[model samples]
Target: MFKLFKHLAFCAAFLVAVSASAHSFKIGELEVIHPHARPTTPGIQNGVAWFGVKNAGASDDRVIGVESPIADHAEIHDMTMDNDVMRMFKVDGVPVPAGETVTLGQGNKLHVMLMGLKQPLKEGDAFDMTVHFEKAGSVPVQVWVEQPSAASGAMQHQEDQHDHSAH
Candidate 1:
């Protein structure tokens, strides 16, 4: 039937689009998966990129740095609480244990800090970045910028608390 053929064509196109947007890269034995960022408001100088790094090798490695053309500098940062106050600081490196996965994102964990933004990151935008590892060297990745509503569940939950409509 014509309807059935049309439906199959639509599904095929959708699947290809999804797979194309899902970007990943590997450096030696390190696998970086689904690097993404949230859209930032105008004039916001900083944005964060989240991703997972899996080390499949027997030897441990470290994430030493990150570089992006969209910002002046990109660094590895960690959020911590001290005396009920939250603080963020640059970390020397993020350890990737042998055969283990390390996640970088918001909420008291390691994430890539993009400082001195050249421009606000908008939804549906894609950018290139390179992550440097201690043993694996540098691996280039494509980062997708998603709207706030499309952010990860953890980020969406944080945004929900700040929603003013409930007041």
Candidate 2:
């Protein structure tokens, strides 16, 4: 009976650790949810990171920057269509409205561009990253690398198609 109880205790602790590692994190009133990147092909120098930023505070906040050792530079990028051409431009900050969630990745509208990648992001890998906010200061986060076909930005594609049909 004693040995069986010990085994169950160990199992419970292991499960807790695994679940905690996969959970979201918060800094003050800012919540960072499921921060992840997609696996990159060999020799690709650029990658993208996506996550949901929820602001529970009564005031607004801005995400000013992101830093990661795996990349030489990281910046916020915005994509738009101009005269039948799609273009991407760097933005200084992303605004998070009060009591709302700002999704950083949705059909290329907004994303964290990781330029000059030191190495290819592999599936099931994770790296340390820091998100700088105007009001919340800096918060450390883990950016997980997921499968290429994951449901990260794919949902946005379907939404885009639906939107186009309305026009």
The C-alpha local distance difference test score for the whole of candidate 2 amounts to: 0.79
Off by over 4 Å in 1: 1-21, 106-108, 148-152, 155-167
Overall lDDT per candidate, in order of appearance = 0.79, 0.79
**Residue 155, model 2, lDDT:** 42
In angstroms, how far off is 156's CA in candidate 1?
A: 6.4
TM match of model 2 to true structure: 0.75
RMSD of 1: 6.3
**Residue range 1-167, candidate 1, lDDT tens digits:** 99999999999998897787676799888999889887889987788787889999999999888999999998876655556544567799988999998877634466777888899999999999998899989999999998533335775444323322211
**Per-structure clash totals for the candidates:** 0, 0
Give the Cα error of residue 56 in candidate 1, in Å: 1.2
Model 1 scores a TM of: 0.75
